[model samples]
Target: MKKLVFVFAFFLCLAISAQDNYYTMYSFVVEPQNEATVYKLVEDYYSKNKPEGIYVRLFENHFKAEDMKATHSIVFLGTQEAVGNMYAGGGNVNFDLFITKLNQYIKDGAGSAMGKHIALNGDTSTRYPFQVYLLLDVADPDKYDAEHQKFHSKHNPPGMLVNMGNVIAGQGTGHYNRWAILGYKDMKSALGGPNQLLSGPALAARQKAWDAYRASNGGVEVVGSGMRVLLGAW
Candidate 1:
């Protein structure tokens, strides 16, 4: 418990920000044949046992790594404390039964990441179909936040969300503990996001802006990047 609080405080990007936006993401593998059944099991369970104040979504990974066996991930959103408490005990017996039922379809636990939402900006009414996740090694949070905010303030994307958060647990802890996500209206927008920005009308200016976004913040390292597709949400 002591370590948990400390990690949250350190990783909860921008400590001044609210803690109500913490998120927990878990990944699992499903056989191609059992994919639909797994989703149906989750949908039916969540539909019946509505956990108050929690919002859940299922994401199908557009896998980049060849060996990454995880096919889908589930994300839970709510206040940090509430989410922590909820997952800490599986919420209740019904949820436990739900998990047990769902586990039969999943091959294994792929991975997971739970942490504070350092910053979140954009529309929430619709969970975009495509999400790009950047695994980063943020050397300086203060500097990174400065340039991140400055760049976005000048040119925020339409119908897009830019989110930066810390990874309190899961893969690459202490190495790449941060992630920046770009949510797009669809796969087309996401695929063309960078090319469209840098290749169109204002190529020079856009290139300069993009360069600055990368150079600043002590040259933040992007360890990896991958996209995710929406499966089910409720």
Candidate 2:
């Protein structure tokens, strides 16, 4: 099946220029018995030291590969430079402290990656309660982005915003090149399939656009997907 990957970039102003948004996502395979402890620790940590200019959200992978059981925390920063500062402990909060607390309950350390946002729609400010992530690989990034943006302009689903970003740093997962994050107002709105959200004509148009998008990009493949709920934010 051809995968549908969406896009989003960060909002930043540097030297009077807005920089492309960057993202750092940490995927953790928590020990099953320690899930509660891990969740509590994560929630508590964020509550106390909320980082600035970064949006932190957590998710449980509702659908994932059998070997990829995990919960993910995605941190959105405005610039690639910000990503470096964050990891190097230049941010307002103590990342080392956060990581120390995180290591105790995780099965493995964490799978981390960095990417740049390419496209975004709807209100990026409002916090949505649920989100779906589409990990994709595209043969041609430029063509894929053009077609996807065209599709979005004509057939966007109501109450849901789309974002796409390309992986630029972090562990290179050979299969994925970009990410599509679909934000929803609530879980109920999120569960509604695309067909249900759009009228017949709009849905058809979307499908056609997607087909063209796939063709132009030399075929897009969905390597992974996950559904997450909003956790406490700083």
- Alpha-carbon lDDT, every model: 0.72, 0.67
| Cα RMSD, each candidate | 5.2, 6.8
Candidate 2 regions off by >4 Å?
Answer: 1-17, 74-76, 88-97, 171-174, 200-218
Per-residue lDDT of candidate 1, residues 104-166 (tens digit): 778777766777676777776767788899888888877887788777655555567888887
- Per-residue CA lDDT of model 2 for 1-234, tens digit only, reads 111111233434334234666777766666568777777877787677655556566666655666564554546566656554555554333655666666766765345666678888766677766888888887777888887787776667777888888875554445788788888888777888555677777788878877776667656888887777766555
TM-score of 1: 0.82
Clash pairs, candidate 2, are: 6-164, 6-180, 7-163, 7-164, 8-117, 8-163, 8-164, 9-117, 10-21
Q: Provide the lowest-lDDT 10-residue window in model 2.
A: 1-10
TM-score of 2: 0.75
